[model samples]
Target chain A: MKRSLLPFFAGTATGLANGLFGAGGGLLAVFLLNRCGIDKKSSHATALALTLPLSLISAIILFCWGTTLPLGALCIAILCGLPGAWLGTILLKKISPALLSRMFGIVMIVSAVRMFLR
Target chain B: MNLIALGIAGFFSGICASMGIGGGFVLMLYLTLLAGTPQKEAQLFNLCFFLPIAAFSLWRHRKNGLLCTSPIKPALLGGIPAALAGSLLAAFLPNAQIAKLFAIFLAIIGIKTVFARRESEQSKEERVIRPTQKQ
Candidate 1:
């Protein structure tokens, strides 16, 4: 791929995944941004910056398409998440991302198995 | 799950999300597998839940000088239309099928995450100039 086109292509894939799954776009963004030669910290931050608009667009489309959003749950989550976000930023320096990633990966695998069996 | 449980899950998921570590996945899993939310609905919920958090995070990152604007324009150009197309495709798919596909995606990501090395362990040489710096 041409160097200039990398971000565009990365964005395409990230947007598609976010729209399709309603999640996971940031993961794709971070990975692709890193591949684009960005530093890890910037990759994470830049991925968020990139995905924010994509997610907004996706959410709007999903809403217009008549997906019944759990508004109450959404509100609760956001309300509680604000402080949690702060805590997470603090923990980011203290915690080992490698360990957290492994643990999170395990949870994802278990959840996938459960979903498959259901 | 009860409201309290949901709130607790939200709190923890928020922490992970802000950390840029796929907290949305954690919330989605909890909603679908534990809280009995439908796959599509859970996805929608996740999207909505993430918006505000992402905005806030972006603000902080910008203040901290972690943001790079050079890639954002091209990325958004490709992302906006693609997001619309993907949403349409998702909307047309049946719930069960979406669930199956989501499971597969989760599995793939899980495997990748498990095998991936920590960024801190990477050599300093991999850190390149910010795209903006090249301008």
Candidate 2:
């Protein structure tokens, strides 16, 4: 029963994190899922999967609240991101989880340090 | 919009999101620091930008059977409303305050990531495969 509820709890935290920060929810989800005994690769994929509906919901709420950017800017951002997303997916399949995990750590640390200092 | 900045932001954000690294923070920082976007607006843009890239990544992951369905329902159950509340909260906070909070959050997660231990590739793959076969 407690085990079953882990996903719900994980989701709640993820939604809050993502909605509040506009990013990092997936990382939180992956961390939580990993603790819940999900494998690293699956945790990563699960985090990605969950981010979809969660982000859509958040986007809808932001839209309803009139908090989003203009249409033109939104379009340009998404279009530009498409190629990166495609390339990322290919890389995801090719990369090993251990290496990805290390990279994720480095990215989080470096970015965090930069943000903190600035 | 600075087309070049937008392009770079979008590209990196897409890659990070697809890889489940939560690239939104990076995009947010880039927009705020480099593109001179207001923090509040940058946060909003990150969410919107995340939508398409995340969707695309989800599709690819699902098609490849990388996604595990077991946690989906419960995660949604908890995540959806919390996200809504978080967005509402973000609206009331000051921009600088939000940035500070974001920085702190990033630092914590970063530390956790750095400390996490990973097994060898072969062992990791076996573990993933073993669990899937059981399910």
Candidate 3:
């Protein structure tokens, strides 16, 4: 198996984000997928599928470390999010890529800015 | 590097996951962009790595106060079979269209999460119907 330099850094970035901050790791995954030449759909689908479990693992470690969270809200959002993700996928079928990209760029910049500013 | 990567990934996976977000994106980025694994391989690795990690983590959280299991039954009743049905159909779909759609979806979530600022609303929305509401 050939190893490359970039993905290692990508993993480190995500791991650090998870261990310390606990946010934006999913977005980081998509950024990697898009940047690395993976088709967008696979990136998203795979990202969604992949995150489900990773989040579970992350939660476990944090609990052991004695972190606190408000579970009720997350469950509602996730319960809503599953259907929402599916619904969003349907709507995406009719949307334009250019529009998506413009919005995506704005969101990415905004999210990063929030993290940086905070 | 592998040890470091795995260690870091495990740490991040727990923290990000408890927040109700996926850490896959971060892991994928690490595998694909940082480690230089191809996109496909990175994605596969993510799913494989995810199942056990997530299940175990959820189990741990359920024991603590961070995770709950009471609501899973109703949701799974409808979700489980549908996921299977959808997966079977997704098998024959086209790639280009899928990629475009994925991009669009991400952009919207990115926008929503980025622009929304009211944490109060988020907190209120998460509270379940009180036991009294069941009647």
Candidate 4:
């Protein structure tokens, strides 16, 4: 495949996962972008950008489906989440790669176990 | 078994994500393990699939009074530009690294959930409302 094609494939996967999971798009986007030859800084920025549109689109769909939600609570969460997200970004830089990877693995396993148990 | 299965997955995933637990872990696993897709490909498919579902869920929440633009707006300031850049960056990576990273992220979420207390199970933090002094 041509070098340019590589990015498309990478984008496709990142986009697919983001659309389906509604989480991890940021982290995974960076990983894929980095692998695709994008520098870390650009990859990080791009990954961060993806979150808004993806979340917005998902939120809209939920609305159409008529799922009940806590506007107040979500608002609080969003309010908290922004700072949390910003803080999280800063914190990520402080962690070692090994520990960070371990953290990531543990998160996934817990999520999987919970769903499986559910 | 095709579109229907996909639709159901999206719906369920949407519910979970809106609940703030994240749908990506489950979505990728289902696609890769149950549906027999390769890890890389499953992730690719799920990313696109998640967008609509998440958007709809957030919208639905707003209808139920869950929507708040307050924090989300600030996030958008940073998130939009970052995502575009990330998308562009993804074009150059190798597949193995992606898989490794995905696995790592999953592991972390799983551990946190396991040890973390459910909001319902825990006592709510008290929110203090103080009276203003008379001017």
Candidate 5:
């Protein structure tokens, strides 16, 4: 396969997963981009960029399908999430790449187990 | 309904966003399993929750020169359709099936994570050894 096409394929797969599961696209993207020869931090950043469009498209689809959530809950969650995300980014900078990768793995495993048990 | 739970979910999701990963899963699971929201609805809510976080994280990453923009266009092109299709499928799928699939997805990611970590460790060891060997 052409190297240039790698992002396309990776995006499609991640998008599909994001659309279906409403999460984990960035996780998958990080892994794929890393394999495609990007550095760990860059992969993470790139994944974030890619995630925006994918989530937007998928969110719109779900919304149009009549998936309605409580307005108040949504408001509270966003309010908290913004700061949380900022904190995470700071932590990302302080942490070593190796440690970050490990954290990523731990999160994946924990998430998998949680989903399994649920 | 629980304000504390909502805050916790958002905070964690934000952290994940900063790491350039999607924390939407955490938000979705929290809402569905703990907060008593329906599965499909929880997913939708989670999506909305992360939009701002993703945008914020991306902007920061770009400003810091961490973001590699080269692959974004192709990714967007390929991802949009897939996302649409996946969304449509999830909308119609039964909750049980979606739950089962979610479990499978998590498990796969977990397994991959383990392997990825190992591979990274091994490569680091190689880089160290190769330099010493050339000395």
Candidate 6:
């Protein structure tokens, strides 16, 4: 694939993943951006920049389609999430992400198995 | 107690999500498995949950000089239409089916995470070598 075309394809995949699953788009974005020769930190930040809009669009679409949102839960999550996001952004520069990434991966695998059994 | 637990989970999920890790997975897993939220509904919650957190994180990243703008335009152009299409497809699919597919996706990401080269180490190495090479 042409180097220039990579971002478009990456966006397509990221959008598809986000829209379909309501999550995971950033992971795809980061991976594709890395493949596009972006450094890890930039890839992560840029992925956020990419996925943020995509998620907004998807959320609106999903809501209009009559997906019942748990507004109370959302409020709680967001309220707590704000500070955490702040901390995460700081940590992004201060800490090495390799260990956390692997830990998160392990947690994801465990969660996946649990979901399968449900 | 439940609320506190949810709050804690939300905090951690926020951290991961902001970092461009798959925080949605954490939130989705919590909602569906622990909170007993329906699968599709959980997805919606995850999506809604991301917006504000991402906005904040992006602002922070921009301030920190970590953001790169080069990829935004093309990606958005391709992403918007694809996102709409994918959401339409999801609307048609059964919740159980989406759940199963999500499980598979999670497992794949997990495997990749476990096995992929340590990104921070690579970046560190790059930072070390770039200036020397430029000399």
Best lDDT goes to which candidate? 6
Off by over 4 Å in 6: B120-135
Model 6 residue B20 CA deviation (Å) reads 0.8
The DockQ of each candidate is 0.69, 0.67, 0.04, 0.06, 0.68, 0.75
lDDT of 5 by residue, B1-135 (tens): 789978987888788776865577677767766777777888788878878888888777777788888888988889999999888899999876787788788778767765665556757877888788678
Q: Give the higher-lDDT candidate: 3 or 5.
A: 5
Q: Write the per-residue lDDT of candidate 2 for residues A1-118, one digit (tens) a residue.
A: 4888888999999999888877788889988887677877778878987877777777776677667576788788899898988887787777855565566677766766776676
Quality of model 3 by C-alpha lDDT: 0.40
RMSD of 5: 3.6
DockQ of 4: 0.06
Structure candidate 6, residue pairs in collision: none
The interface RMSD for candidate 1 is 1.5
lDDT of each structure? 0.81, 0.79, 0.40, 0.45, 0.79, 0.87
RMSD, every candidate, angstroms: 3.9, 4.1, 18.5, 16.0, 3.6, 3.5
How would you encode candidate 3's per-residue C-alpha lDDT over B59-98 as one tens digit per residue? 4434433332322333234333433333222223343332
Q: Where is model 1 more than 4 Å wrong at Cα?
A: A93-96, B120-135
Error of 6 at B95 (Å): 0.7
Lowest-sum lDDT 10-residue window in model 1 chain A = A89-98
Model 3 chain B weakest 10-residue run by lDDT? B67-76
Q: Lowest summed lDDT over 10 consecutive residues: which window, candidate 1 chain B?
A: B123-132
- Candidate 1 C-alpha lDDT tens digits along A62-103: 888888976777898899988887777666545545578678
TM-score of 1: 0.90
The digit string of per-residue lDDT tens for model 3 on A1-118 reads: 1224434444443333332223344555444433343434334333333344333444444444333333442333234333333333433333422344444446444434332332
Model 4, position A45: C-alpha lDDT score: 41
Model 5 TM-score, 2 decimals: 0.89
Q: Compared with the real two-chain complex, what DockQ does model 1 have?
A: 0.69
